[model samples]
Target: MHPVEDHGAPGSGGSRSAAGWLVLLALAGLAAFLLARPILTGPVAGLPAVAQSSSPYTVHRPAGGVRGGGIVNVDTELGYRGTLAAGTGIILDRDGLVLTNNHVIQGATALKATDTRTGRTFPAHVVGYDRSNDVAVIRLSGAKGAGLRPAAFGDSGKVSEGDAVTAKGNAGGKGGAPKIAQGRVTALEQTVIARDDSDGSSERLSGLIETDAAIRPGDSGGPLFNASGEVVGMDTAASAGFKMAKKGKGRGFAIPINRALGIAEQIRQGHGGAKIHIGRTAMLGVQVRPVDAGRTGSGGQSADGGQSGGQGGGQGGGAEVASTLPDTPADRLDVPTGAVITALDGEPVDSPNTLTDLLLRHHPGDRVALTYRMPGGQPVTQQITLASGPPQ
Candidate 1:
């Protein structure tokens, strides 16, 4: 199970169509879903390069060598299998504040960014994130005096269909100057259900701008600029199995810049809500799955030597621990693999999602009471401390 949230644009229809999977434009060797249990896999090699532009629209590198622009190449070290992922970001302030998609840094253990303008790399930290909206803000260390340039933002509400647009980013995760793909806005207020290829979990993103621009992997969170070179949207998901903009082919989606900025502002002010998480995530360091009805008790038998059911022996609804990470709080406290977590700090944890939500209300070093039940046994409560984990 994974943490899930409900979010949609105002006045947008409440219907979610089961469209085909929309690939998130983040460059990584293997597909990994946000908030899912980690699985080690072999590295995938030889990602294809972005298609060359043949349309009349321009594809040249930006003038002044990226130092004049507000984009940066973001690299993240994942918590699993030495995996590295790359994406793009837009500078929001001279102090290295950046706006990006939450999925770009979802499972990051460590993050670093390179300023295209000066070619300087700096360590970065997440300021806050709204996973429901797929928006995040990160601040670059040692960038206070670097004189970073901020991207010019335009009113997304004023944008009209058929308006000329250009999407720019690290096209192939090649990590240098940003690449540009020019096209026109084909639609607005579009909604799409994006599914994670790794886990089959789906999210509905509403009020997006649709374009034919050749937005590809490694372009996630890059700026979608209008004809005036002002950002009107943030490049996000793209249609799969389409060639890159040959004769105006392929489809891309972008979150409106105005809406993204609004989320960023809330993060900057340290405001947290049901959907917004401020600062680092607290980790229980355990992999879990929903408890199955059949195997709910000790040795697959109830206390009365019968199948476990309502009040027979097993906890009715809770997350079953599959495994615990070594040296983490869960392992340190000897949380049994076959036990079901029934509560956290006296609050009932009915499922994996409930457990995740309860943990989000805490921080590192906070000691809390954990309650779990062994197979066919009474609930046991233990005190444990939480540790800091990678971005969720």
Candidate 2:
């Protein structure tokens, strides 16, 4: 009631109080802006890119070093644990198709894949396996099945030795994230043998990229990345006779990831145990019809399939000599039928395909000689000229 009469000046204490509040509010707004600047810049990177999925890899490391860890974990978005070993896997589909190694999940009774950051583990069911290639695809079920982080893949053939490389995979144990390794490739067109003694089976991996980057068993089934971080190969084995890679012994092997991808896709699409075409490669000119086992003879012993006209499994004798054809690369040299050439460039040649694969490494015009034994066991030397196909 007294305000009208008691007011000292027109806009005195009330105005001052209002101005103070305005200044405080303005300062508070600026403080708020500064606090949220980092968040406002963009979405935080540590979180998974896919809306609600857990990140596949971790951004932080223990401060020593990491090569492809971040890329594998962040990009592949899946990790696996199994009997052969624990490794990383790629999510090939939005519905949770994981591509891993046959050896990784081979003969495993149970499997559990978890996002290292989420503590959420998904039970993975083995969909199918290809023993020929040592590759497998896994399907995740239940809550962790959706919102997967799929990696980008590329043509592996385009990658060449000496190109910069990155690898993503699980290292250590279940707590591990996709670790990184980087180096120039040491070799290509690699051939490594994997033997399953338990089943008396042997398999070979060819067309592989061998690198000096150090990797471990846990790295099997992981992805080998290019500079762009796109997966180019599937991390598989160490170099031939390379049991383990330690410091200063940089060496690792990766299968062309493209092949694994193709197989995995087919398995996901409902073709189980499907034989992959891998594109048949021809090596020699002589095309021997599958000679019947009982009808033909090789090393004087035969099987139901056939004589295996090439080298029979037993004791190594010579480089392979197929049934001769008229005017072909072999016939051009007058290679006598039943002449078994044992070695090429000082190594025992086992299969005709391997020899052909080796020959392809040389130019069509290159000169290749043979060391073989004729029917009488007399050694014969023939300097043979190479050609594209079975010489006419």
Model 1 regions more than 4 Å off:
1-68, 243-247, 292-316
Judge candidate 2 at residue 342 and give its lDDT.
Answer: 50
**Model 2 over residues 1-392: C-alpha lDDT tens digits?**
00011143433211211101110000111111111100111112232211111212221111221223222221121111101124556666546566776655532335556544344567776676554566777766773454555666755657775777877666533334556677766666666555332222234565667777665545667778878767777777654333344553656777776667667766555554324212111224443222233422344533223212345322333333435545556667676665555544444444442443344344445566656556455566667665533100
Stretches off by above 4 angstroms in model 2 are: 1-85, 116-119, 143-146, 196-201, 240-248, 273-392
**For residue 129, what is the lDDT in candidate 2?**
53
Question: Tens digit of lDDT per residue, candidate 1, span 88-157?
Answer: 8999888888999887777677888898878999999999887767789999999998977788776777
lDDT of 1: 0.68
- Per-candidate TM equals 0.76, 0.48
10 residues in a row with least lDDT, candidate 1? 20-29
lDDT of each model, Cα atoms only?
0.68, 0.47
Angstrom error of the Cα, residue 5, model 1: value is 31
Cα lDDT over the full model 2: 0.47
